[model samples]
Structure formats: C-alpha cells, structure tokens
Target: MQPTDVSVSGIGTYHFVYKHDPQTGESGFSHLITPLGTYRTFSLFTSLGVERLTLVPWALEAGSQNAAVFTFDWETRVPPSGFFQGYPLARFTWPSGRRVNRLWAKRLVVYDNIQINWDKEDLLDSTSVELHDSVNEFNIEEKRQFGAGTLVTHVRGDLTLAGTKRPKPKRSGLLTYTYEYEYDLSFLVSGIRSCLYEPSTASPLWCHRAHIAFNSWSGYSISPLGANHFQDGLSSSLVLSQTGVQLNRRFDNSGRLLTFALQDSKRQEAIINVTFVYSVDSLLPSDMNLETIEDVPLRTHYRRGPGGRIEGIEYETVGSSRRRHVQVSYNEESRISDLRHYISDSQFAKAGSSESKHITTKFLYERGLLSGFGSWKYTFDEDGCLIERKLRDSGSIEDLFEYDAKGLLRWAERRVIPSTTSEGQQKTKLEEPFCNGLENACYPQEMGQVKDYAIQYLYDAEDRLVVLRNTLEIDDSIQFFYAHPQHRNRLTSFFHHGKGKAYFLTYEQQTGHLFTIEEVDLSAAADSNPERKVYIIITDTEGSPIALYSDDKVN
Candidate 1:
C-alpha cells in the first residue's frame, strides 16, 4: 500500500503462551489471558481481546470492533472459550485449540527514543520493526501481578518493512510474511501543548524526554534536557555568575508567539523587548512594537484580509515623521499582481494627497505572472508565453521573448529606444540565446545572431553535447565533458568563462559533487587576504546546495 498523508496501519503477530491449570485440568493462560470469544454472528469470533489494532475516528469512523480470529495449537492448546457456534475454520481443525502464526498490530506507540538507523537490521529471523515516532499509538503490554515464568522472551529478527516478500524470518526455510504499513499523525493541538489520547482504550502511554535535537554526525554535541542547545556556539540560557545573555519568549493563549524579551538575559540591564499583537481571529502578527533596542521607538503594523492573508505592512520610526507602507493586491488567478508604496508624513492635504506622498511605485502582473514593474505591462502570446513588455508611461523600451515548441525559452531580446527628447531612437538591442532540450543546455546555441563569429557544437549520434566554442574569442565560450554519457545533465567536468578568467569546473573527490575551484590568474589573486580564497561548503553527505557567500564575496 502506498503511504498516504493521513493514516497508517499494520498487521501483527502474537504468541500466546499457556500452561496446564492443575485445578481445571485444562490449558489456561497463566498471564495475559486472551479475551473470551463468543459466537457473535456468521463465521465470526466475537472478542479476541487484543490490544491496539483499533481503527476509530480517523482510525475508522466506527469506534472499536473488539474482535478477531484466534490462533491455537491443536497439538497442545485449549480452544477459545465459547466459539463452537461462531465462524468455522476447519471441522475438527481446532477441536483441541487454535494454531495461528501471525496477528495484526494491536497498537502503535510513540517512539522518540529510537536512534537514527540507515543501517539494515536482520528481521527477527521472525520479525523486526522500524520505530521512530514523536507521537503514535502503542501496544499495551498486559502483565499480571507476580505472574508465572518471569522470563522475558527476546524476539530476535531483522527490522524490515511489513509485507516485504523476502523469505519471512522462517522462509528460505524461512516463513516470510507480508503486511503493508503506513503511519500518520492523528491529532495536532494549537493551544497550551498537552497530551492526546489514542482512539483505542488499550492504547499505551509514552513521553517525550525533550532532548535538544542536534546531529552528532556534524560537529554538534547533544545537550541534556533543560540545558541550552545552541547553534554557532552561542548560548541564551547559560547562567554565568552574575551575567548571562538568556533570551526568553512568551506566547499568547492561542499558542502564538507574543513577545521576545532580553530581560532575563542580563538581569542588571534595562529590558529590551519586542511585543506582537493580533486580532482575536488572527493567529498571525497584526502589530509589532520594539522597545529599549534603540534610542527611539520602532514599530510595524500588518493589515490582513478576512481570510487572514496579509495585505499590507506599515512601518513607523520615532524620530522620522514620514512612515513607509506597502500594500499588495492579488489578481484573478490568486497570484500577487500589484504592490503599492505610500508614505504617511502629511506632506499634502487630505483631498487626494500629493503625488510624492501617494503611491511612489506600483508593480503589476498579467495572468498571475509578473509582467511589468512600475507603470509597465506585459503581453503574452496565444500559448500563454510572455511575448512583449513595454512601459505604460512611455514606450521608451521593450523586452521580447520567444520559446520553442517544448515550452523552453529559445531567446530573449531587450531594446532600449532613445527618447524623442534625446538622440532620435538609436534602438540598441541585445539578445540572449538558450540551448534547448538538453538538461544542461549542453548544445550551446545555433551560433546565428546579429553579430557573431563561429560557434561549433559537437556531439555523438546519441545527441549528447560534447563540445562548444566561439571562434571569435577563446575566452568567450564554454565546454562540457561527461563521466556517464547517458546522463546528459551529469557533466563530470567543464570549462567556464568567468569574465576573462578560465575556471575549471571539477568534482570534489570526497563528495563527488561539482565545485568551481576558480583557477584565478595572478591578476585576480592580487586582491587581499589569500586565506579567503579557500571556501568551505559542508554538503558532503547530504546532497543539499548551499549559498554560503552573499553576492560576489571572496570565493
């Protein structure tokens, strides 16, 4: 079964141990006896007396069924009490008792104590289970006070997905079983976070230890509960002698963040705080006030729609009479189409407001897409592709777009026309061409343009892009190479033109990921601090892209 976002269910197995009751001369359970099964209806046992395995509410709109089939050993075991009238398994099959090997999962339990496991475990030659949960229904382990045979059974098995077809721990001479499993959250609370109960009465209880969740694989240490868990080695809860920068926070009744105060951080200093306010129906911030951080007061207000979507934001500063505000409006397609700017400084009369005091700028869109910025509007082709854009105030400039049949951008052109007041419309046009179809845009371009030299694109019969270059200048082109030719996007190494500097694009042997160890020339390296040339990116194990440096900073 495919895992859905809502619910998870699993089937399980139970081994009922029984001993001979000397007084009754009958085999009865010494501890954790199975509930008596009565003949409820057609071929059905009434109550198998199981724990968990109940579907109520989200589990199953119907409460609890409290019934199941029995598994017993005809060779040595008693039949469930009062089941001769109910469903029939096999005539004379269990005249003595029932014999079943597998059962359904009785309950799901919250398991936060489970450690991360990427390593495969042998399913208990019988059964192995994967467990990691913040909150989940769990099986109730029934125990009798001082019951017989205190020996706890150690069920050894491989941890595997249920219903997996590999020989069960018993198939291969192993008896493999199959059961589909999917777990989902049941209840999410929004108030003073408290506990929630499982749908079934037999649901067991588990608690969260509240440990600071930090990864040990990375250079991070796990702190004890209640201890400060810090990122970048800065602590807000550490108490040192008479001084500590302990940050504290408070939440409203709706569990929404209300205030962030530095009062507790340094007790001797004046409290520096920021408070958030909201309407009764809004869980989102409506207003925010900052105090004690600067000499003057600073504040911001949020205007929201009936649906709770933020519509505008206004900012106010203590010393400045002028305030800034931004208002947003959505188009028919529910995408942001316009953003308006305004200043509240009483620079004009209330009649209509002065031009400078009113909308300073307005951004517009077409068909739910950004079409223009400030008095400009965009027009699209029949295929809903942007074809042209021009300013509403004046057609001083225009941008043109073209696309291939595959919906890939082929080229774009920008033309700046000289205003009538200037040098009579010289119309300077610049165009950019994009390679199509290939994942890496490997083919380069067709080499046909208003002004160009020769650009050669070489590839095998497989259509893989191998080489590209502009005969005009050696430093103005790019080249590609591959380790796995079939994977077009997987360029093992390539050469890039970094504004005159030739960069060798290669993979880090340790991570098999691409990096540009910009082979800078002496002219480029002449700049400051050579140490900054070495950039460190830590996406070694996980394939996550990182933008460590902002803008054109160092390497």
Candidate 2:
C-alpha cells in the first residue's frame, strides 16, 4: 500500500505549523485543529418526575484538521410518549493559527422543560437518545447539557498535546495521540407538555428523586482478574459519584404501583432505597480460539552443504489420517530415495482400519544442485539433466531436449497432455534465478531476441561492465546494495538511494540474524543535518522479537 498523500484533505490532514529559528537554523512546530462536534449523552426519565440529562462530548479527534463549519443537535425522548424534542445547544467559530489545538465546543445550549422533572441519580431507569443528521450520515451530533442534577449543570474544559511525533516513511515506528475534554452542565427549563395525558386535567407529581454530586474524588479500585494480552491502555480507576441522584415517587398516591414499586409497604420502601454504585474494573481479555497442529512421522535423510555430506538420517513411523507404513534408504553416495509414498487399500476398511505405505527420497549434488533419488527409477541425459520425473500412483512426464555443438541446452521442451497442468510446471520459471547464477560464464546466444528477460550476475570492482557520462537511466534508478562477508560467514545488507534515504539491516556476525536497524533521512533540507534513528529488537525462542529500545531525532 502507498503512503497517504499529505494534503489538507487526506487521511493525516492535520496541519503542522513549523517555527524556524533564524540564527541556528533549528525548527520546531505544534499541531492544531478545531473540534469536530461528536458527543454522548445519558438521559433519565420517570412517569411524573423530572428527566435528567448528562452530556459528554466524544472529543477524540485530537490530531484531525479543523472542520470548515461544525454543528451539534440533540434529540431526546421521554418514555410513555412518542414525540421527541430536539435541542441545539452550542455553535461557534474557532480562531485560526493557534499554537495549542482546542477541541472545545463553544456556546453550548441546553433546552429544559419545567413540567418534566429530571431524576439524575438513577441511570438504570434512564434511556439514552442519539441525535443524527438527516442529510450527511458521517456527521455526528454533540450534546448540549452536562452534570448530574436536574436543577443545575456544570461545564469543565481541559487541554493536552496529542502524543509523539510523526514517523519517517517506510520505517516501523509507533504513533500516539492524546485526547482530552472538559465537561460542564448548567440547568435550564424552557417548556413542558403532557403527551400521554391531558395537560389541563393531569396532576403534576414527582415519581423519582435523585442527587448529583460534582467534583467529588472517589478512591481507586483494582481488578481481581489477571492481566490480559489484548488490553491497550493502562489500568486506572474511573472517578464515580461526580454525578449522583435520588429518585422520587411519580403519579398520585391513589394509583397502583407497577414497574417501579411493590404493593407491600416494606417492599415499596426497599425498592425506593436501592442505590447504584459505579466502580472501575480492569478491561477483560478479548476472546480468541486456539488451534493445535498434529505431528507426522517419517524416515528421511538430511543433507548439509554443497559437497552433499550425509548430515543425518532417521527411520520412524509417521502418523496420518489413514493407517500407513513408511520406508527409506540411501545409496553409498549418501543420497536418500523414496522421500514420500502413500498407498491405500479397500480391504482394510472392513477390518475397521485403513492401510497405506509412505516412502521418502533424498539426494546429494556436487554444488547447490540436487541429484537424482536412489530408490526411484530415474534417467538423465548426457548433460546430467533429469529426463523423466514421476510420482507413484499419480502420473509421469518424459522430458525431451536438444543441445548445441558446445553441449549447451537448446530447444528444450516437454510434451504432455494439454489438460495436464502440474505444480512443477508452474514453478519452473522461479528456478531461473538460481540456474542463471550457477551458469555464470555462459552467455545466451540469442539474448537480445528473448522477451521479458533479466540479466543476472554479480558485478565486482574489477568487472566495470559499463560506464557512461550523465546516464539518464542511472540518474533515475533506485538501487539496493547487499554485501556478505567472505571470511565471517555472515551477511550485512544495507539499503540506499530512495525517498527518505536511509541505511538499514545490521545483522548478527554468525547467524545472519538481524539485531539492530538504523535509519537516516536526509530529504528534509540541504543545510539541515540528517536525522538518524535506531531501533533495537530482542527475540525469543519462537523467533518473535520485541522492541527493546528506540532512539530518534524527530519530535
């Protein structure tokens, strides 16, 4: 995937204003953006009592570009009635070019009806309402009111910088952004009506009473469960009782109690005495499934290096979906034969078991090339090339080849059924790289005549194959350089010449295992010093590496 464009309207569109020092040429800057109006609200209602409103703005857009225009609308519904009233709480424009970004929603407006009493203390009996735009589905509506009580609302605001600096391109780095918002709610009542009952005849009564506390600090609590792998943030307590309430009785005393109360006097009192407690607990682990791999056994021989020395050989029974037997053997040349052979019989099914046999094949070659198997029937041409390849119970192919005067392969072709497409045929092109490297000095007679070809060779200082002045192709080319130490038996590769130019890959001296990677970018400014960053990775037995430490020059 390509890196997103750094335009004003792209994914990472947050504008970063830079401040440059004239004397030292050092520069620094901060990111800022206006608030995008998205908020969450908790609403409570009783049949006859007041309805409480708790609004929280979802100010998580800490690093987003400022919207040209923003607005919030809240729609709330009172139970037992179908009609919903919407309130537009706040609207304002933010000043441009501020060093510190602001996510605050200004001029918040809350609509209140005096006839409907709000029960702030009881949230379980409360219902949540969401306000949505009729036109643009992406736009979210913000809540206007805040705080815990029906008669009063409080508003609070806080600010903090979004976390660490942006990462250099193509280098693995972490990006973090912090989000914060101040909350406050003020009390107000505009109008009231009776949607279910006649407004003139219906008597006003308080069904629930609630208490809402503000700015109260509650003690912290820890989770009893063990730590989970998937939890992202630190475990912390959630402040409670900042908003509290007591629900009161609704409707006339003569009416029978239903959803909110019991008939017995003691039962009614117990129901009224019920209280809610909000305590913080650690987030639980995400759900996951585990799958196990079954072990299979077989007899085979392993070869080590170019000379094809028999490193080791083993004979064992391998498990399979069906009953089977395996046999393996090696020739004096240390080449293994019959690597895998599967056999199945029908008579074993009547005996409540299946029967089959398996065999493994191994080979040794002079160089990196593989020789023929020992046990399987095989044939080779005068050039020591495999002529016939076959698999037991499946099919076989006979290769036909023609050679030139120098014994170089020419006009090579394989004849088989048109419908027979084998796995080996599909992978033949992939072996061209190794084959070309093995035949280093052999030049193709018809090189220019071939299409879709690549020149594969190692060019050393002595070669100096080609040189030109102001070469157009060389100027625009991207090059990757790798070097393997001859004496150390290890590889240390580096990347050069690219956008955000850098040096990467400082591998181990013995195993070629990567230990550390350092990246440097010089594309910022001609006069400015290049930025160098280093990341150290530590690996466990399973080859899973964890970042141990990191140091960077960017903010």
Q: Pick the candidate with the highest TM-score.
A: 1
Clashes of each: 36, 47
- Kindly list the per-residue Cα lDDT of model 1 for residues 263-317, writing each as its tens digit: 3342465345566788887777788776653356678888987466667888788
**Global lDDT of each model?**
0.36, 0.27
* Model 2: per-residue Cα lDDT over 1-555, one tens digit each: 322223432112333344456896644432332122222222222223233232222222334443222222222232332222333221221121111111112211111110111122221122211222122121111122333532212111111111111343322211111111222343322111111111122321111111222322422221111111121122111211211111122222223111111112222231211111111221211111111112232322232322433333332333433322233444333344344434444446676534333334455442112444432234443233444433222233334444322223333333332325465763453224322221121121211211221121111111211111111222221222222212122222232322435444443322334544555564442424566654544332122442233431101
RMSD of each: 24.7, 34.5
What is the alpha-carbon lDDT of model 2 when measured against the actual structure?
0.27
Candidate 1 minimal-lDDT segment of 10 residues: 188-197
- Candidate 2 residues lying further than 4 Å off, grouped into runs, are 1-328, 341-455, 461-489, 494-503, 509-555
Best by lDDT: 1
- Candidate 1 clashes: the total is 36
